[model samples]
Target: MVSISNSVKTGITTGTLRRVHHIALNVQDMQASRHFYGTILGLHELKGEEVPKTLIELVAAGKVANFVTPDGTVIDLFGEPELAPPDPDPKRGFTRANHLAFDIAPELFEQAVEVLRENQILIDHGPVTRPTGRGIYFYDPDGFMIEIRCDPMD
Candidate 1:
């Protein structure tokens, strides 16, 4: 494996990339997505600058809704009323392979599972053990796979 330091020395990357600022997802309903991420997931939304009235109007007309997680992760939900939701089956050609994983403490893993269960969110996979730690996979309202891991890669 190429070390980050070695990659930096070789100019593979600038080595200045700090962290991911946010992620965006397309959704069928902004309100439902908001409730899931904000209420069910317990991510605090950052109320920053006021969106322009015109933009707000557009969003109300089924454009989009942008939200930020408590850790500064921005989740953009695009309103696509007609598009079919993503497929959950990984073997399906149309299934989304990319996903987002949040790091959490080992002690909280069970609590997270309970929260997901209470919300009626289906678990896609295990609280399975990995080399790093335990992880569980589930789908969002949009059928986008999400992972909660007790350990993150160093």
Candidate 2:
């Protein structure tokens, strides 16, 4: 049997990376996509600026999409829709693996559902239980799957 040193045992810390800085996603239309994330999702528009001929960036801050429960996170919406992979099988429905997962406070589930329904957006699944806990799946205007989840352990 091999023995490990105390220093080696202490090296592995129980922690995660501080927080997600930003998630960049390609959208068919920058303006409409920004509206979906900012207006519909209730994320505040932090910045929406164009950078020359290359791309446009739309940043937002909010809770449902935040790094902290109420501290807000930065979501960078990119303008180059052509950059994302094309769905080879359009008839197969949304098969792209690219997505963003967000942590939603348990209390906000109802408001989230109402907001989504009011926006005429279709939900893929429910505020039901996973091993992780209750969650809901939905899509953005750009067909990017977004998940609102609550960790059971939390």
Best by TM-score: 1
Q: Give residue 127's error in model 1 in angstroms.
A: 1.3
Tens-digit lDDT track for model 2 on 1-154? 7797776644545575676555655566776776787777767655334222232321332211211124555665656646443564322355446457777777776788788888987677786787867777888876677777776745
| Runs off by more than 4 Å, candidate 1 | 1-12, 48-62, 86-96, 152-154
Shift in Å, residue 147, candidate 1:
0.4
Give the clashing pairs for model 1: none
User: How accurate locally is residue 103 in candidate 2, as Cα lDDT from 0 to 100?
Assistant: 74
Which stretches of model 2 miss by more than 4 angstroms? 1-17, 48-72, 81-85, 88-98, 151-154
In each prediction, how many residue pairs overlap at the backbone (N, C-alpha, C within less than 3 A)?
0, 0
Global lDDT for candidate 1? 0.72
lDDT of 1 by residue, 72-152 (tens): 666767777766645545424244356788878787888998999998986788879878899888877777778888874
- C-alpha RMSD by candidate, in order: 5.6, 8.0
Q: How well does model 2 score by local distance difference test?
A: 0.61
The most accurate candidate by lDDT is 1
